[model samples]
Target: MHSQPSNEDRPWTPVKATGTALKGADAGIVIMPGDALAAYTAVAPGTARLTSSRPLCATGPGKISCQGIQEWTVTVRVTRP
Candidate 1:
């Protein structure tokens, strides 16, 4: 999961958002909103839930602004049952 919009901030910066599956990974890992994360997973039949994460740092839109640094950051926790 990765995304680096060429123009993330602008008068008309298209709210870049999308999701894509891995190219060769064999699993149900669906990245959410721009493949920025592995937000969901299907661990087994009829059993699935959202992954967890800790907020390391976040900035953008209204949290914080810089000359050319507009983005959000976080650390996702991978769990297994």
Candidate 2:
């Protein structure tokens, strides 16, 4: 019989944003670079998945004012060609 897996056994990976930016005035939104891999890995046959721990913040005029420390996570998957 197959054994159940624990959270520690999950295949989730950690990723970070290379940059962050605020977009739009009316609909101001925070944007950041998701998961990124080497060109070789990106061109592989598998899919990449990205997941953020929390919503990014948008500040400045006409945007959501946010302060304090915030964190997020991004995940990606790559396969061999």
Candidate 3:
């Protein structure tokens, strides 16, 4: 969660494209400035992935078109002990 890749101009944000095994502690997507700290609760015994994505380049006028994307993932496993 710490020392990960991040951009100040274009920061990395969570991708809720699919269902996740870990549910967010907050009501909705929680993203703080210059930080990606968030809590999640395991709903069931399974494996889940928390992901974040960012464009390769900053999109703006006169800037190079962003043709690629970068992603970061953290795998979480929940089991009954």
Query: Highest lDDT: which candidate?
Result: 3
Q: Identify the runs in model 1 with alpha carbons over 4 angstroms from their true place.
A: 1-39, 42-66
**Best model number under TM-score:** 3
Please count the clashing residue pairs in each candidate, in the order shown: 1, 0, 0
Q: Candidate 1 lDDT, tens digit per residue, 1-81?
A: 854332222222212222221112233664343233432332323322233222222335564343443344333233432
TM-score of every model? 0.22, 0.21, 0.62
User: For residue 47, what is the lDDT in candidate 3?
Assistant: 79
lDDT of 3 by residue, 1-81 (tens): 635334664566754423456776764765565445567877777777777877777666775676787787778887841
RMSD of each: 12.6, 15.7, 5.9
* Count of clashes in candidate 2: 0
Q: What is the lDDT of candidate 1?
A: 0.32
Of candidates 3 and 1, the better by TM-score: 3
Ranking by TM-score: 3, 1, 2
Candidate 3, position 27, lDDT:
47
